[model samples]
Target: MSKFVIKDDFWELFPQAEIAVVVAKRIDNTEASAEPVRPDIIELLEKANEDAKKFITKDPLSENEVIAVWRDAFKKFKTKKGARCSIEALLKRVQKGKEVGCINPLVDLYNAVSLSFGLPCGGEDIDTFAGDMRLTVAEGGEPFLALGDEEYDEALPGEIIYKDDEGAVCRCWNWRDGQRTMLTEDTKNAFLIIESVDPGRSGDLRQAAQKLEELTVKFLGGTARIEFMNINKKEIPL
Candidate 1:
């Protein structure tokens, strides 16, 4: 079983933090399409966009309840908020009348769930990970390659990131995934991470995680499993 741990430093900053990890194996990545949009996935994305229109119309992206929570978290970890986290970026795009476009079946499915639930959700190809993964503040200089970028970037000190024994897998907590562990058409196993800082929305987090697992199995032809971790329970065995 692979081990996933939330470092104590992270809990000290956000005691209410929670993460849901969904693991899927034997995924059929051959169906992945960079330009194809699944009708079912499009329906979910459209509905989420419609639902988000109401909240964004009432207030700017910076003032959104869900986005605000993450903004505060970024501040606590010494990183800027907007244009960082996946959920915030998605909301910002929808707020401006842009639809989240499809990438691949796995990515599209998770993006739909993240938008529908208003939470930060991302995943990595598990086989690429070196060892057990940990969520903690960076000490600086960890290698990172943002999506579509060819050159490597360095993580800022004190920024929150997910790292394995080798190096950082994600920089700025749900902001961007590193190319080293990104999910690709060849990925056969993956670990998806959904995060929440609002204690009151634990139910929403679980619901989103369940939906992610279902969608992964439905579209990727894999067996899925999920494990939940919070301030109270910091570790889980895969």
Candidate 2:
């Protein structure tokens, strides 16, 4: 069973929320590809992105739009393709205005799927995550970046991210990932989050993340730690 380190603050943040986490078995020193890629993964991304576009846009974005902000990003991913082009570009469009970076296949996949699902998920290089981890909001003026290596003067507060004793393992929850804990070609241990907007949606979100987990093994040659994080409704995601 996945261990949940629950606190009273969780209920206080999300009085009517139900949250859960999904973690996969850990692997050490597994190898990833350096040749960029061929086609299969790309094709998979194309199809999965289409599915996510439909799923994410279903919600509002700002005040009342559940996933409308995703619509802006979907339009970008739908048309871009290249050895250099990446989901980092699309994320740049919707990060509520922030910087990002580029890790590798595993990290890239996490961003792509999140963009597709429109749910804003993330993955981290477990090597950097250390032993214990938790999710919480940003504290502002943290001085960070996503995958593109851009600079951040502010993260505001209430922005969800997977954090360890060090600080932020995955910033912006599902939106942007940190370069410090990115999955490189040398990355072996990976922690993934298939985030859910609410309790009822957790099942679908978790299932969708499973597909990505499968692909990680198919290409990365390592065991994985997959987690399904059910967002607490009472908690506002910055």
Candidate 3:
């Protein structure tokens, strides 16, 4: 039910980068002996605190049946809770954020992997995705999605996101689209995105995103179009 594409245009951004287009099929690795979370993933999680730390959530997923993790997360929206202040506010706390609430699987994957990698993770409705994607430095004043259909007053505009034929897939590098575009129980095919500055240290975060995609395809009976990009620094040397 999902499919992903990495356009040729995107390759220009990582021409010399040694990156891995890794795919980790699913996220229900709860067994005591299952593949322990990748080391880098754990490291990233350990680096966050406060609201940033608040991103991770526990959702019971199994390899045989990885359904919509977000379905469970919707229940929290009823509390009238919202996103952290600016990205800066979120960064300040997640270095050691204790879980304050629950979230769905896709979100939990982003948050959990984020905690260990110290990298921001996000996604959008691939079904709603319109065109080619690009990543750039933030303009700072760009508007972003807080959750669901709500938008925030801020953004990391100079940063990067998987922009499609539409303006943005989500908001550059922060929060993402609402359930309207999010993957659901009915999703048969999906598009995914995960990025970073250095591909070497980013395998785990990349893998986590893949896991979410793979798990979805299994339980939901669809396919996926996964795009793992390494947004190299324009100034960095090979």
C-alpha lDDT score of every prediction, in listed order: 0.83, 0.47, 0.38
List RMSD in Å for every model shown: 2.3, 8.7, 12.9
**Candidate 3: regions farther than 4 A off:** 1-97, 136-161, 175-180, 184-186, 199-227, 231-238
**Residues 91-141, candidate 3, lDDT per residue (tens digit)?**
444323433222443344445444444444554444454443344433445
Candidate 2 lands at a TM-score of 0.62
**lDDT score at residue 72, model 3, on the 0-100 scale:** 27
lDDT (10s digit) by residue, model 1, range 108-153: 7888888888898898988888889889988888787778899988
Better of 1 and 3 by TM-score: 1
Q: Is candidate 2 or candidate 3 better by TM-score?
A: 2
Worst 10 residues of 3 by lDDT: 61-70
